[model samples]
Target: MTTTAHAPLLETSRALITSLQEPGGAYPASPTFSAYRGYCWFRDGAFIADGVSSAGEVASPSAFLDWCAGVVEAHRTPIERVVAAAAGGAPVPQEQMLPTRFTMAGTPGADEWWDFQLDGYGTWLWAAAQHAARHGLDVTRWQPAAGLTVDYLLSSWDRPCYDWWEEHAEQVHVSTLGCIVAGLRAAADSGLVTGTRAEAARAGAEAAMAVIHERGVAGGHLTKWLGTDAVDASLAALIGPLGVIESESELAAATIAAIEDQLCTDDGVYRFRADTFYGGGRWPLLSCFLGLAHARAGNTARAGELLDWAAGTATTDGLLPEQVDGQLLAHEYRTEWIDRWGPVATPLLWSHAMVLRLAAELKEDA
Candidate 1:
């Protein structure tokens, strides 16, 4: 993230950020990186918030923050509109939830979000708080916009929309719940999710943690979901909040250790064995997430090593790919036909954004 070393990262990210935009402030469900394009989604918006916050924090001139504010604002009216329509009995057609997953009451189901996903609102709430805390409190801009996000998350916290994986099944999900936990803490710091909001967050987080206790092991690692002892790369969500992992906490250490053992490939981390249904593979974003976690946990040497690995994986044009080859060859599974961008070797916004955030953190702490 040094100015000169990351010039290509900056240029590439600026463009990707631009490409993610939709007219109404929401991002495309996914960039036409695959078959889908142009649908505004809750989950995508949540992850998008992570990247947009990074751009706002590190990308100079800071136009992206304004763009970021718009992203959340776009969802407010649309979501309410869908809910209102659903209540009126003339629900929006499910087909209308383009791109991917999402649902507002009786509205058409989400494009990609066929199932519930509670974390999208949580992620958005946390993202807004991050912008205010790291940068100046842009009350004029972020407060009003983020306020709505806080409200949305509060309303949705207790009621499960969907887990992060979008598995319609009702099993409690640690990743989504973790975000809700972190998001609640973040929003409360700003007094956004307080009173009833605070109570709901506490109740929800407690339930989720109880689920984690039942599902996750104390060996410093966590089971991907409750009741199944499987591991997943998605837990990278845990590392983003702050210095969470401590040497003394066996469960936390086990969780990180489990990630290294189960998910971390030479190239990067992956969700889990079951995630292949979505064509999941070794993910480039997971590498940076691990790196960020390492950095937060005070393992600078390890963090830097992983950071170098992540940087090296960037496409020639500097975009992060959705996943990397297990062989670490850069082109193992990358078929032009498989991707919508058609062999456009690119970095995922999540990977680059985490990198940028970590770099910023390193500098500030240094």
Candidate 2:
């Protein structure tokens, strides 16, 4: 399908995202999904902000970045405490770190959650810097918070935290490390961090890159985490929008091949081989991420095909569900999740954001 064929859905997605943005600049994960309602994840919002920004709707992303900055600033004391502990070799527990998602009011979720992922903070820094650069806006507005994030990440980037899927909390995820490298590079390059901070950011990125290269690759492609040979759809992001790894590099090609051969089908991209969450259905957002990597690698035609597949997942109402169970990996597990958390999250902001992002990239390439 051509970009023209998907124009209506694209327009609806843009409108939906801007409309659902909270007054405080937070983008709720999903407006009506039970487990996701009333909270915003930094990782999800950053990508959403990047998508909205790329789609030529700037205000929503700007507001979201402003909110991100405010949230980080509000936790300055806790951040300093965590940093000091790490510096002193007495690192605090994972729960003591910042949460993975927050209320729209910019506080930690009142409800329990898998709340200690570090990828989101790095993602926010990357997205905020990219937004400022893309729109030619000043970056200083968020510099203080970005610096705080850098400090927080530098302290605990080596620790075992949750992966993007919120599982494997005991292992160092390669995708999470990619996010830190991207964010640190952005902060260092965009002058959002300077002096000793800039040096640290650059050093931190290099250190993370070294670790990724040293232990994150297997069979010439990126792996799920350090010391594993399994591949994940999320790995495509490092070679794409994240821009941590060069898209044109040999390793990028191997990773794309691995994900395509293993996790991707004609329908969509699965998160990982072992994933059974929501019956391990294919995710439209992951498809877009793989599409992005393909586009950046100069495979426009393949990229367009992936974009079309993602668009096909949208509901008749132009809403994209988190994942579709039509071709689930573990079909038997579907109903129990449904009984617990209701149906899969529909009108997921991250899903819409990714579609917007890939659509924009394909249109630009065309």
Candidate 3:
């Protein structure tokens, strides 16, 4: 049960995330990667904050949450407008919505990128509530921003934007819906919303869960999209920390089994089959996710093994790459991405965060 072997690596991961965190409390996707440089994603930062929170570090995530509050507040007027328009049967253009990522200074990036994803906003709500509850902090501090986020989701939750991979903008991804459900449920339970707002949040969560059950499931497992039978590793989060699917549920079990049988490799897990980004190598973060789901489901031995594989993917300096280049499904396309984006992202904050998270789970269980 001893986790002493991981002590140094875990500490190193913690230090890496802390060191790379921006002065404005944003965790950059990576310090110097060509593709993700200078960007702070709500989805990535939420998971990163959760990892730091689990390690019992409060200030970093608190600052990040405060930054999140500011970002949400800045977009409040637009979000309200969007909601009003939606209610009037005039939905705003997807491009007019708040972006998935922002600069470290808390403004939307001017550069062209995939900006329509709603999952990040939902993820921030969930992560912020989790941090507040875990630390016994006041949720009211971020309530206004959380309200804005909830309203935005309520207006646009049904719209298909982008998946976690930033592809398939035309499909209603199960992972995206799962994130909204988790966030709304967390906000509803945070004691920050009341009366109509609380009722709406709860009702929204129920409706979203209904959609997931009705259309997001296939072959007894959660599908990548509404009509597709494919599985994405991100779906694992739904059964773990996301709680969109109960860890002990039959559906959760089937999803995990499918991921293992199809996407898992010797090094780690791929984002999905046919992933060509960075040659579709095994992702350290997704491995941590599957491990986390296993840990939550009481399969500690399997979780530990996955965690060990993730830890092994780290460089000698203890920095984890976004993915390792083994078991690549698209080796032919590797050179194209490398030529375009330089090397694959090294020390990706999300990867390190997942490693820290899985390590903490093992230590706590031990």
Candidate 4:
């Protein structure tokens, strides 16, 4: 945990966390400064706090913490809106991955894809629950948001909003449902949203997962999407967070093992599949989550190595790019949408948080 050389990593990471925040104590979804009135999102909330938590007080993700608490505190109204929106023939938040503000709230300019993910609500639930559990905060602090999130997931999982790729869909994609399941499982475990809500979260996650297992398992590996034989590293999110897959399930073990053996580059970044998508680019978040998958499954040493590799791709400025080419360490930028502000910055809050969570493992292993 006490790496003599990790000082710069910690310092840079802290600096980035400080920069990513809105002055009033919220994250603006992405660093992609925009004119369209951006707000915090499920993805941002999860990772922004994660990054700060990992910075080890070198800097505080407290801006993130304040944002989460404030938003969670305000949950009663939004939850009502969310429920009303769903009940009144509004679309169920299908996991577009936005925080409540952008999801239910209106956006003027281009707000598509990144910020309005309905599945993101589930992630918000998961992150809040995890934040409460990890920090030993009062679980009740997260209950309502967590509860509404779970209810939302169950009420709308089968319906379509947006896939992880942000494409509208009725077709089941692995990333969407997987994230939903992982997030809900987080809510259920948080001890805040229990009983029916917890059961529903657990069930939704399981059901979505069942869809994967029944149809996804093929040739001795977990397939990426339902009915498609794609092998995506994104599945790592489910296996990493749940901890259920790694311990007893042969499929989880084999799937992760396959990812490490094939998808993980020598430098530790993850390519979704070397043969497909965005020129077979390496995904930083997926790589970090791979480390978590290992760690969550009790393979600390392997996790440490993968985390080390993943850390290499982070810029000297501490912003984790969306992709770091494995063989050559090529940095790839996925431009977020344009708005009144101009071209968007892709310093995704999720990537920062992934690094932060990885840093937490360092302390624990120490």
Candidate 5:
């Protein structure tokens, strides 16, 4: 799992990510994938930014963070309006809120999508802080947008919206809460906000964690959402990359074990047991996420196994797809999506980013 051992693919992933980063600093979800082409997600880009930053590439992630700040600043009016409305007891329609993805030019996408996800905003805050901290970069440049994001999240963190997969828009997802908590904590610690904003960031993060402790945990591990006992592959992220929950803690250990037991297989990890998207194929990114969690928990051997499985999913050309067809959960739905979107998204930036991320973790551990 050392970077030296996987230098070829790791180098290819790094080059591909940097090459695909839009001129505006936006990282397109995928360049050739039909549905994802021309779009960048704050959530995906933040994770990708962290990956790029982790690989010792500063300028790439810095520009992405700058782009994220610019995006929030550009829509300051709408973001404040939504926050004020929610504060006054009348939440605006979901459509009026900020979107989940945007054009590489930093504007909202022209086409409609499950666009109201809150995790991305929080994720941006987290990534910006992490990058600045990792490299000792100045953080003040992002403070204005960070303040706006903290206000927006503090106002509406409890509202139900889309999950990471853009599904179940009606349920408040636990993974989303983890992102918010980590972001808020980062903002509070980053010296990026001051006065009331910083105070609110600390309090908001604590409140979110309280909610998770009271309602998000079930059967000794984190649940998919507040009321459900179901686990999603995403919950593993809370332990490692996000660090909302400590990796060595009992809750983190149990959550990782639950995901491995119920959702993981020899191929990779499934999003959830009932997932049907892309025939519910194993995701290389999710496997890397679980591997990261394991690495943080001091389970290097298991982490290496997960990384190898994910690496095996790469094409001969070293491109990683959004997910693979191995041991699909709902093979029946595969053809329909292929006919609609044409083959799975190859060279998914997030997949390559996750591989870099896990490899970095293992390399450090080694």
Candidate 6:
């Protein structure tokens, strides 16, 4: 349970994340990867921001939050249109909706991508509220955009969009719903949202939770999607910092046990049983998520074990890769992706962010 040995790695992870962050406040998915090199995803950046904030780097996350606010504000009109369309049960074109990742300049990327995901917007609200509360700052600055985001979620929360892994856009993902619930609850509690907006958001969160309970559960654990029984590593976050599910709840325990049994290896955790991205290598971030869930459940010894395992996956230079090849389920497909997109992303900002997050959790327990 000792974190003394990994103290240096903790500092290194924080520094690496800070160094990779762009001056304009974007945290690139990876600096060298051809595919993710120039983009900043709200899902990734929110976690990264929360990590830095937890590590006592408040300004770093604050800047990122400001950038998010700007991006949301800039797209206010479009967001309203989409919300109105959804409310009226009219079809909204995917191209007209808000995008998932944006350029460093805070504009949507011109390049083609799976850009219909709503989880990131929700995640950003939750993370921003967490930051503001932790640092005793005014949440009002983010309220305008946050309100738009809430409206969007209120209208479209039940729609099928992309999941955290940016795949399966046609299915309603439980984890995606969890993110919306968490975000809505956070926004409602921020003291900035008022009147009908506040009431609607709170009711929306409760309705989302009811849906998750009725359809997202399978055999006591949260399923990957509403109709299926498969579990995903991302579900661990529901019981962790996201607080969609209580860390001590029976459902949370079952979900964690499922992840450990089905997706986790001695090296790290996989996205899912059928994942083939980057040869389905064990993901460093998911390991940190599982560690965080364990830490929240008061399993400090187990949590420390996961943190140590994640630290060991770092390269010799202390850079954490997005995923490791150990126990790769799709080993046959590794070379294909490498040839197509170059080597796997090293020093992935999200991976380092999760490392910092878990390390901070362990340190707090220490």
Candidate 3 residue spans exceeding 4 A from truth: 364-366
TM-score of each: 0.73, 0.98, 0.98, 0.75, 0.98, 0.97
Query: What lDDT tens digits, residue by residue, belong to model 1 across residues 39-119?
Result: 444444555555556555333223434444455566677556554565576655433321123222212343343544556
Tens-digit lDDT track of model 5 for 1-366: 244767788888999999989888999999999999999999999999999889888999999999999999999999889988998999999889899999988898878798999999889999999999889999999989999999999998999999999999999999999999999999989977888889999999999999999999989999999998999999999998999999999999999999999999893999999998889999999999999999999998899899899888889999999999968999999999999999999989999899889989888321
Worst 10 residues of 6 by lDDT: 1-10
Question: Tens-digit lDDT track for model 4 on 1-366?
Answer: 356345566566556666656675666656554532365565556666655654544224444544554555565565566666766887545443234354213222244443345556665566555555556567675565566567666766655454544443655666667667767787777675788777877887888778767876776667665676656676676666544355446777887777777676664645454333333466666777887777777787877776676667667676666555435322232221222244433465666567667657655321
Tell me the deviation in Å of residue 153 in model 2.
0.8
In candidate 6 the C-alpha lDDT for residue 222 amounts to: 99
Ranking by lDDT: 2, 5, 3, 6, 4, 1
Error of 1 at 66 (Å): 7.8
Counting only residues 3 or more apart in sequence or on different chains, how many pairs clash (N, Cα, C under 3 Å) in candidate 2?
Answer: 0
lDDT of 2: 0.92
Least well predicted 10-residue stretch by lDDT in candidate 2: 1-10
How well does candidate 6 score on lDDT at residue 158?
92
lDDT of 2 by residue, 1-366 (tens): 344768888888999999999999999999999999999999999999999998887789999999999999999999999999999999999889999999999999888888789999899999988888888988988889989999999999999999888898999999999999999999999988999999999999999999999999999999999999999899999999999889999999999999999998784899998888888999999999999999999998898889899989988899999998877888888888999999999989999999899988887422
lDDT of 4: 0.59
RMSD of 3: 1.4
Q: What is the TM-score (0 to 1) of candidate 1?
A: 0.73
lDDT (C-alpha, whole model) for all candidates:
0.55, 0.92, 0.89, 0.59, 0.92, 0.88
Question: Which residue ranges in model 1 land beyond 4 Å of their true spot?
Answer: 1-4, 18-20, 40-44, 55-115, 138-162, 194-196, 218-220, 242-248, 277-280, 326-347, 364-366
